[model samples]
Target: MKKESKTDWPRINAMRDEDIDLSESPELNETFFKDAVVWPAQKKQITLRLDPDVLDFFKSQGKGYQTAINKVLRRYVEAQKHH
Candidate 1:
């Protein structure tokens, strides 16, 4: 038997709120968001040098390449903190 994927967005959106099922969903409360950290939207400007290949790779991904690079660097910093 083939397994069904859960990408049925149209059908899901058409559902009435009362007809929707939420038995498997976890309850969210104030405690769930108490410790959440909010990041500042402001960005700092700095000059940095990168190898030609590295810069080219991100540039090929089209717009928002700089943001993508920042995200990768952020993940690296977060991982290093756990050590």
Candidate 2:
């Protein structure tokens, strides 16, 4: 028996042949580097307690669970910064 894997997102592959309109789109060349790269994270790691139910909820999303959690945390941080 073997586990199943998900198919890759076609848009990403299709991006290779995409006829991007650089003049119309502001974000096309927004990044500093032209090459594909992972953006840097502004926050540092710290251990914190979370309810079992909350952890289970994000884990069920299958992938990018940590990214979801970080997004929530980042929203909170951004709100606090403006106060």
Candidate 3:
């Protein structure tokens, strides 16, 4: 995990328009995104191998570690689709 910088927002906002890329960005259509209901997909059980530290980190957060892992994986899948 990486430490987040508190001042990153100002730096990002200061970036030049030409420095930004929107080629892969989705269109901001209100009608397309409005009233969206994201229901979780059915889950399947399986054994997965993970680094000891990675497993320990989520487990240390106490309860719902499995759900946290699922959320992380889902985000990764969604991100990959945009690329």
lDDT of 1: 0.87
Candidate 2, residues 13-79, lDDT tens digits: the string is: 6765456556754465546355444556676778978999999999999899988998898679868
lDDT of 1 by residue, 1-83 (tens): 29777779799889999888889775677875774556868899999899999999999999999999998997798789976
- What's the C-alpha lDDT at position 60 in model 2? 99
Q: Pick the candidate with the highest TM-score.
A: 1
**Candidate 1 vs candidate 3: which has greater TM-score?**
1
lDDT for model 3, on a 0 to 1 scale?
A: 0.87
27-76: candidate 3 lDDT, tens digit per residue: 87886587453777878899999999999999999999999998899889
List, in order, the clash count of every candidate structure: 0, 0, 0
Residue ranges of candidate 3 with Cα displaced over 4 Å:
1-40
Query: RMSD, model 2, all Cα superposed?
Result: 7.9
In order, what lDDT does every prediction score? Answer: 0.87, 0.75, 0.87
